[model samples]
Target: MPPSDLDLLLRLRLVVARVGESDNANWWASDGVLSPTGQYAYDRIAPRTGPFARARVAFAVAQERCASQVPPGALTLWTLPADTEEAFDDRWSHWLDHVEDWAPTFAAVEAINTSSILTALVEHGLIDGQHADAARALTAAPPDPSVRLAETAHIDVDAVRQLAAGFACSQPAALVVPYVRSNA
Candidate 1:
C-alpha cells in the first residue's frame, strides 16, 4: 500500500533532522515536533544564504506542512504558554501570520529537494525499482502535504557522503549534484 501524506512528511522530517549530524542528529523528536536542538538547528540554518541552503528551507516547508494539516487552531489551543485562552489565540495567530512570510523559502525548499535530494536518493540507491515512479512524480512540483506517500521513503544520501567526505579525500564533490532535470 502507498504511504499516507503524513507518512511522507514524517519520513522527510526524519531525513532532514539528521543533516549535519555532528551538530543536528537529534534535531526533531519521533513525533515530528521540534526539540530544543531542532529549534537551534532551525535558527542556525534559517539565516544561511548560499549554496546548500536547503537545511533551513526544509524546516520551513516541514513546519508549514505540519501546521497546515492539523485541526484548525489546534496548535494554539493545546500549546498555550499563556495564562489566558484569548492571549493564547492571539499569540498563535500572530505566529501563523509570521509563518506566512516563509512561503518563498518553502518554495525554494521544494525546488531543491525535488531537483537535488529526490534524484540523489535514486542515484545513491535509496530509491529503486517499484518506488521510482512515485519519487519521480514528486519532482514535478511540491505536492500537497496530502499526497499519497511512497511506501518507501528516500534516503538522505547527501548527508551520508558529507560524513564520508569528512574521513576520505576520495569522496567526490560531484556526488550530490543539485541540478534540476529539464524534464523534471
Candidate 2:
C-alpha cells in the first residue's frame, strides 16, 4: 500500500527538524565562521552534497509523488515553492559571508512554523481533535516578545500584535487572530 498523507507529512517534519538541528549544532561549533576543519565537515554534510542532500532529494520526490493524495491546503501548509530552494541556497551563502550573525530569516521562520500544518492536518481528519485544539490555541497566542526583538528591537507590544494580526490575515489558510496580552 502507498504511504498515507499523514506519513508523508510526518516524514517531512522529521527531515526538516533534522536539518534544523544539524544547522544549529554546526553554527554553535563553528561560530558561523567555517574554518578549514569546519569547511571540511560542512562539505561532507551540507544540503547540496551528502546525507542531507540525499535525504532532502528523497523527501522532495516523495512529496511530489504523494501530492495528488494530499487534501487541499495540506501540501501548502508544509511545502514551500520551488524557488525557495534557490533562495535557501542564497541565504546559506550569505550566512557564510556574515559570520557569527546567523539567525532564521523571517520567511524561514514563517515557513517552518508547524501550527498551520498541524491545524490543516487536523481539519483534514488526519490528526486528532485534541491536536487541533492545541494548534489553534498556539496560533491564537500573542507573538513572543523575543520574536519581535529579533525582527526589530524597537517594536512595541501594540506594534507586535498588529503585525501578528496582519501576518495571520495574509495567510491563505485559516489562522486565529492572536489575542492581545492583558498586560499590554
Supply candidate 1's per-residue lDDT for 161: 26
Candidate 1 residue lDDT tens string, 102-174: 4443333223222133343344343444444433443212222222222212222332222212111111111
Candidate 2 regions exceeding 4 Å error are 1-48, 71-78, 82-85, 92-184
lDDT of 1: 0.30
The alpha-carbon root-mean-square deviation between model 1 and the true structure, to one decimal in Å, is 16.8
lDDT of 2 by residue, 65-115 (tens): 324433333312224333433444445444355433322221232233232
Instruction: Please tell me which predicted candidate would have the highest TM-score against the true structure.
Output: 2
TM-score of each: 0.24, 0.25
